[model samples]
Target: MLKKSLLLFSAACASASAESVSVYFGNGCFFDQQHTMVTRFEKLLLKRSGSDVTSVSAYAGGDSSSSDLCYHNEGEVEDYGKLGHAEVVELFIPDDKSLKDAAKVFFEDFTQLAPGQWTRQDVFDLGPEYRALVGIPGGVSGPYYSAIVEANSEVHNLNLKEGQGGDDDTIDTGVVWVMDSLKFPAYQAEVCLQFSDDNPAFSEPYSEKYHSLRDALFEEGTLRNTTCPTNYIC
Candidate 1:
């Protein structure tokens, strides 16, 4: 199936008309134990959506397996930089679909992890200043701000599913969904969001800070209402 998927992706890439969007996984590494999780999510988006969405992974670290990786610096560097090692997953969305809606679907599904996984996590709707700092473009007027949600377990442990490792190994980790714009017309327009944190999830005011932000985003429509598709996978 993996080979088949790649072939299909290649064909899609060859086509002249294909829309694209980039999703930055802050503190996210493709080689981590949970790498498959994001890949599966990517496939799901394409399968369920009306558009032909193909994705590619870009890493900000050495190719060596033992190299340092994680979201060490997010939004602080010129190149898709993060505080820790991270991966930028680019999604090519078909022209027929709204990139906004496609992104909404990805976020909605991500937050739907197993009950235990989400129960302790706090979600945040980033403020305008931070939103603009990342990639989400817009003023305080529209529902354009991005969301930063808490991860239920330690960065390393969270990668594995329920039974893969000790299920109880949970920690405070932050992830966000961002939207950006593309400069040239090759793929036309582009929007990207980075899910990043500085290992401050367990920190004093930061934890409380994000929870409060989550509440505000919901109220302001930054994190608008999204219902899961009847047969969708979380």
Candidate 2:
């Protein structure tokens, strides 16, 4: 009887170990701009991990109102789309190996956006500030195509203003670079990630690298930290 009970307990543990990991991607207002990037990122993650990543989903309603840093009492509730500051992308992994593999891919792919890749001189001019905003370590030269790299960097000392008492005078410094030229209007892209579980195995290095990218992007002025009262947009 004891042998049979032990077998049942071990089976239950094994089943639990095989539980699925769900990944979710949320995009606030800039859904269209973020779609292609997210798609590319997702494909890369799947390819690198060689794990069973089940599906990818998008939500269009905008970030949750309660978390907005610029929240106002009289603001029109219908403007949810305009008020949202960030978008999200999520993935689910079936096991630990899959999760770790996906994370490794994420780090590798993101690091490739360094300043050395810009091909145009005009865009290259703005690379430093872009790097500063996104917290990239060095500078690059060439064209604006590298702006994506800048936008993928970081923002530092994010301070939120609430009511009249909070620090309002501080115009939180971030990297900003102009991309518009003789032919085109200036544009920028920002990317960020949020994980559901606090798995220590996944959080540490991922967070560090993410912060580096955030600094680089913010330094370049392509990404801004709009996380309000809460440190997260969603």
Candidate 3:
């Protein structure tokens, strides 16, 4: 549905230095009807990662006519299930941080990082759109990439399968998939779904503008309006 790159790499790269990088991941169960639960998790991601990161519920890691896709609130069908896209979170990591900061949160945040609470067979099934995966754009090699590969492998107690890919790469951790983001791209999700319960101040200027744009894009109550803010910002 969306036809854009995961991150505006060309423009972002041009403007910011290497210290400030945007890394994206399909972190499972991007959507939640429970407003309090969503905000609590958002705060956790911001706090534990130890970064003032901006995030969104996004779609990625499946074939499409184009790389970009959108999340539709499906009652019978799961979000983006028809398109085979995975529910993901696109995080904007601020200056002086590396991919590992994001990686730490991805691997350590929850007991099980896979998407959705119930499996597909359950009547309450949230579907398979929730898959745990990490993406790094540009095929860029350095300490940051190595850190991701290393942490991912360590979490799974895996050894590097050399000649397969990166020296420390794991194709599938039996639970997580690690790959270059360009392979299966990500883009912004629906606008009303942008920041959800978190305040725009937490996510920089984009959140404020996204709320307005979300209003323009969807009709009232079409998408759940962001609930009351629990905290000002993390």
Judged by lDDT, which candidate is best? 3
- For model 3, residues 1-234, the per-residue Cα lDDT tens digits are 232344433433343455555556653455431121223433454342112224545666565534335445333223345666665676545432345545655664334225322111112324456555565654234234676775655554322221112112122233455545555555556544554543333222333433342353233222232322222121
* Model 3 alpha-carbon drift over 4 Å, by segment: 1-4, 7-15, 18-20, 31-53, 73-79, 94-97, 112-125, 138-144, 153-174, 197-234
Best model number under TM-score? 3
Q: Could you tell me which 10 consecutive residues in candidate 2 have the lowest summed lDDT?
A: 130-139
- Tell how far residue 148 is off in model 1, in angstroms: 11
* TM-score of each predicted structure versus truth: 0.30, 0.26, 0.52
User: What would the TM-score be for candidate 3 when compared with the true structure?
Assistant: 0.52
Task: Supply the global lDDT for candidate 2.
Answer: 0.26
- The candidate, 2 or 3, that scores higher on TM-score is 3
Candidate 1, number of clashes: 23
For residues 55-144, write the lDDT of model 1, one tens digit per residue. Answer: 333332111221122222333322222221124343444432334443443333333355434312222322211111112222112233
User: Model 2 segments beyond 4 Å from truth?
Assistant: 1-18, 25-53, 59-85, 111-234
Ranking by TM-score: 3, 1, 2
